[model samples]
Target: MAMSLWNPTKRNSVVLGLLSPRAMLTRWPSQWIGGALADSFEACVDVQRTALRDAGPAAFDVLIGSSWGGAVAAALIAEGAWTGPAVMLCPALSELRRHGAIEAIVDQIAALPAERKAQCLIVHGDADETIP
Candidate 1:
């Protein structure tokens, strides 16, 4: 998986972009949490953990996730895997539930400590049918 680093300001920032399963089918310049598609949700998280270990969690400044990837990003923070800021765009929590993915992660996200929860920003559109 490719992780991009850019100097948006005086300080250099590393942005990890996690693409959704559908997005993976496209030619978008993003990657799954793991370099390859995972067979289970836990496998996905494991790859992210490995990435953090290899790259150092502190190396990342922000996490940006789209659709199912958003759910993964939220899980990382909720499970204390990542302690940095994240931007989740239309996380596919409902779709995950439908596909038999872990449901408790959602609760875990809601129950996150205020300070940690504040580090995440979720963007959802009211008219979005896929993730509504």
Candidate 2:
């Protein structure tokens, strides 16, 4: 989970931040962007099933994810686990092949409700060296 608080005093909004694999290892982009966003920033090393589910509905207002994190965000939304909107930057959906379960993930994404799919925003950079 990645989140930055624009105002620590104001807990009305929470934005989940998903970090890239590289960012997770180095804590650069994650820390830099997350730190600059707001004071309520939180980073999740990994999006585990129990943890994400336990976070409940009020845990985040929106999700912003990069690379692998974006894939997790997409999976969560596709599985009907998350209802809020999402912003995926260079989502590594293609990397699912490495898990030997890309089909399962695709099926899950395909099963998403129309309304749920409508709330997501996916941005893939042509020059993205990581996912590309």
| lDDT leader | 1
Off by over 4 Å in 2: 1-46
lDDT of 2 by residue, 1-132 (tens): 433233333332123222323335655653644433222221222343457578887887888778766776766666566678899888767754443324565688777778877888999978877687
Task: Give me candidate 2's TM-score against the actual structure.
Answer: 0.56
Q: Write the per-residue lDDT of candidate 1 for residues 78-127, one digit (tens) a residue.
A: 78888888999998777666644646788888888898888889999999
Error of 1 at 16 (Å): 26
Tell how far residue 78 is off in model 2, in angstroms: 2.4
